[model samples]
Target chain A: MNLKIALLGGDGVGPEVLAQAVKCLQSVEVTFNHHFTFSPALVGATAIDQTGNPLPDETLEICKNSNAVLFGAIGDPKYDNDPIAKVRPEQGLLKLRKELGLFSNIRPVRVYPSLIDRSPLKKEIISGVDFTIYRELTGGIYFGEKKLNEKGTVASDLCEYSEKEISRMAHLAFKAAKNRRKKVTLIDKANVLETSRLWRKVVTRIGESYPEIELDFLFVDNAAMQMILNPAQFDVILTNNMFGDIISDEASVITGSIGLLASASVGTDFAMFEPIHGSYPQATGLDIANPIAAILSAAMLIEHHGLNEEAQAIYMAVENAIINNVVTSDLNPDSRFGTDYVGNYIANSIVDTD
Target chain B: MNLKIALLGGDGVGPEVLAQAVKCLQSVEVTFNHHFTFSPALVGATAIDQTGNPLPDETLEICKNSNAVLFGAIGDPKYDNDPIAKVRPEQGLLKLRKELGLFSNIRPVRVYPSLIDRSPLKKEIISGVDFTIYRELTGGIYFGEKKLNEKGTVASDLCEYSEKEISRMAHLAFKAAKNRRKKVTLIDKANVLETSRLWRKVVTRIGESYPEIELDFLFVDNAAMQMILNPAQFDVILTNNMFGDIISDEASVITGSIGLLASASVGTDFAMFEPIHGSYPQATGLDIANPIAAILSAAMLIEHHGLNEEAQAIYMAVENAIINNVVTSDLNPDSRFGTDYVGNYIANSIVDTD
Candidate 1:
């Protein structure tokens, strides 16, 4: 099989960590006897520095031509602090998502037994905790109409949703639930917000099509509490863009290592995989940032392409690395392994296992 | 001093637990030699059942005439499950906040040493966690204009903020911080939403007047993660309505006992106190509900009236009850104490201490 993958190592530690994922993917190519072509493009702060646009036309064209896009991280400290900055690094990523029509963001959170003690939660609370979040990425307040009055005394942002938007994500969540614990908890503010009521109505209708899936509801505020008090109660959480952003990030920390979470964003025709962690500007060029999330993202990309066995190989290698204590400082502070060392170790493990 | 207080025990365990708070207040009245008048009013689902209105005219009138209001819980599963119902128990509380101009909702979260083991988080993470959340109550998406398309295919909710709205809450949060830890963290989505930028701009300007206090900012998503990762790092959290609702609820569970948390809603001319926990319909008549939160709310009411010593008396008594293990089943599952029993114990302790 031949696969074309777009690689966007946006900024900061994104480039270093993504390099490790590429190395592991190359190892997979040799071990599995598959042909793969990698196309590199500039995006985010680095792209803005060079082309004066976060998502240059060339970058979008490269991504449009690829089978799947593997994204590292984006954002820079310089752009984050400036509220009035016209061209921001995040806008580049947001524009890419809109252009690609990526509407669903899938993030799976799981607790590894070996690292259970590292979590801030009690062992009893975090043990056996595994859940996935289905977030609507293309719509809601982030893409809604925003306005600032002439006097600048008042500002507003619209949070709008259509049945088409809600239904597409609902179908994805229900399909995923069928393969998991067969439950989907839709989190929204239905009692107060009109959009939430729409979400409940459409999702309820969609649930009828999937008779095997058990659908439930939770107010976003209550869901936030439940996430801390009892995260294991959830199987798949579906929510709007803003609530999803907050809930998924909240869910990410429960595993004790934000460095190990990977996410995939999918639309009708395009999909992008990336680590949930930010660019980590402080760790830029240090070669100390964790590469596991990026490597896992590569595995997800492979799985997206219908290569189940190859994806499982990557997962097995990652799990083996964790069990053997071949991890970066984020997981085991005493470990002396850097990003490249851990990446090389995982790549080697994959080849040796084969 | 003479005081007029409106008491609204709306639904479920609201009336039962609120009775305990009233009992503690009565004990304070007798011990402090003050005259207090209690006016009973109907609100929430119970009011809807009797009068077909959640917030009746008489109820609003009673609240307007009172100096301060002591509220119980609201909402019922019967109303909560029905999405199309025109009347909701929550609407009463939202209307009351708007009518009374209660712009700020204050919730303080602290970890009690005696109940520290009950927390889901590790002891080290929640040991000295102490912070207050100042939430803008009567603005943002909850009170914004909501629209549903004629075909019901699309829905939108506006999240608007004015300089006036942001500054008023900012002043209260800054003033509160002046008395506690001299730091205020403003959480918003300035990186994406326009209203958030306005929040940052207004709050930054307000921080200039309070030179002695430190002001910081966090994106709402990052703030959600930080709340779980290191809650102790926060001193006072100031945020808009929706984020506040989620963050405060999330912060409540870190202390292990949501039943022990209390909140206050205040305006220029009036104030209201209530427990942060909701009406537990399951435990309504069983007397198994915890009353500490209600009792603590009564303490806040006294403090609002400038009776600090009187408030301290209630706090000391409540602490004495917890220290003596005279708590409800929620606090100590093995203990057989009921709501009335714990309330009586705390009231008796308040009198005995005087």
Candidate 2:
């Protein structure tokens, strides 16, 4: 099988860590006897410097014409300090998501046995914790119309949602639940927000079609606390965009393994995978940044395409790397492997696998 | 000194737990030699049952005439199951807040030394965690104009904030920081939402006035993660209504002692204190309900009235109760103490103290 993969290594350590993902993918290509054509495109700060546009039209064109997109990270400090700047690196990614019609974000948070002790939570609480968050990406407060009065004293943002928008994601969650834990927990502030009422109405109607899957509701505040108290109880979490942004990030920290988390922003015809960690600009050239998250992201991309065995090989390689202690300083300060060494080790692990 | 207190022990365990608070407050009055008059009023589910109104004019009048209000929890499962109910038990609290002009909500999350092990987080992470969240109560998306489109398919809620709203809360937070850790962290999603940008601008400007206190900013997502990773790092957290509701609750659970959290909602001329826990309708008539939160709320009400020594006495008595293992079932299952027993023990401890 031949696949077209677009690589958008944004800024800072994005290019460095993304290189490791590319190497691992190449190894998978060799072991699986599959053809993967790689296309490099500019985005974020790098694109802004070269073409004066954080997400160039050409880059979007390449992504549109690809089977899947492998994204690095985006953002730079210069853009961060300038709060009023009209153009920013994050806008590039947001626009690309809109342009690509990617409306749902899938983040899988699983506690690895080896890293359980690293988590802030007790081992007993997070031991068997494995859950995926399905967050609506396109149609919440983030994309709503924003306005500031002429005097600049008052500012407002609209949070709007439609049944069609919610049912699209609700169907996905219920479908996923049927394959996994068969439980869906919808998080919202339904007690207060009108939009949340609409969510409850729509999601409940959609949930009826999937009777085999159990459905429940939790207010966002209680859900935030539940994520810490009993994270194991959750199977699949569905929430609006803003709530998703906050809760997913909260879920990421409890696992105590930011370097191993991967996420995918998917649409009807397109899907993009990337590490959940941001680009470590300080370690851009230091060769100490962890590449495991990037590697696992590649695994997600493989799994997204239904390459089950190929994805399993990548997962096994990652597990082996942890067991063998071939990781960056973030995971193990005493480790001798650099970023390149760990990447190569994982790639070789893939090649050496039967 | 003489004072008038209104007790609105609305539905469920609200009345049961509030009785414990009243006992402790009476002890404070006796020990401090202060004249106190107590008034009872109807609100919430009980109010709806008696007066057919959640927040009756008579109850509002009583609260208005009182110097301080001691509120127990509200809400009932019956109202919870009815989504389209025109009147809710919570609407009473919202109306009271608006009627009394209460806008700033203060919730302090502190980890007691004896209860450190009860938390899900490691002792090292939460041992010294102490922070107060100053949440804007009367504004933001909760109170914003909500609308459903003509077809009823589209729903929207507006989140608006004025500089005046941000500055009022900022001043209070900064002032409190000066008396505590001298640091304030403003949490918002400025990069995505335009209102957040306004928050940054207004807060940064106000922060400039306080040359001593250090002001920093964090995206709401990062703030959520930090609450679990390192809650001790926060001194005073100031945020808008929505973000505050989520993060404050997140912070509360990190202490691993939900039965011990207390909160206060303050305005220019009025204030109300209550336990952060809701009215557990199932635990209504049971003696198993914990009263520490309600008792601590009484302590907060005293503190709000400038009775520092009296408030400290209540705190010390509660601390002693925890030390001597006189807590309810929520804190220790094996301990033989009912809600009234724990409340009586704390009151006696206060009376016995020098």
- For DockQ, the strongest prediction is 1
RMSD in Å for model 2:
2.4
Q: Write the per-residue lDDT of candidate 2 for residues A1-354, one digit (tens) a residue.
A: 789999999998888888999999999898889999999999998898899899999999999999999999999998899879788998899899989889999999998898889999999999899899999999989999999999999999999999999999999899878878999999999989999999999999999999999999999999999999999999999999999999999999998998899999999899999998897788888999899899999999988888878888998998899988998989998988899999999988994345
Report the lDDT tens digits of candidate 2 across residue range B1-354: 788999999988999888999998899888889887899999998999888899999999999999989999899999989978888999899899999999999998899999999999999999898899999998999999999998879999999999999998999899889978999999999988988999999999999999999998999999999998989999999999999999998998998998899999988888999999999888888798999999999999988888878888989999999999999988998988999899899988885345
**Model 1, B1-354: lDDT tens per residue?**
888999999899999999999999999888998878999999999999999999999999999999899999999999999989999998899889889999999998988889999999999999899999999988999989999999999999999999999999999999989988899999999989999999999999999999999999999888988888899999999999999999988898888988899999988898999998899998989989999999999899988888878888999999899999999977887898999999999998885343
lDDT (0 to 1) per candidate: 0.93, 0.92
State the local distance difference test value for candidate 2: 0.92
| Superposed Cα deviation of residue B340, candidate 2 (Å) | 1.9
How big is the positional error of residue A8 in model 1, measured in Å on the Cα after superposition? 2.4
The CAPRI category of model 2 is high
Write model 1 residue lDDT over A1-354, tens digit each, in one string.
799999999999998889999988998899998888999999999999999999999999999999999999999989889878899998899899989999999998999899998898999999999999999998999989999999999999999999999999999999989878999999999989999999999999999999999999999999999999899999999999999999999999998978899999999999999998899999998879999999999998998788878888888889999999999988888999999999999988885343
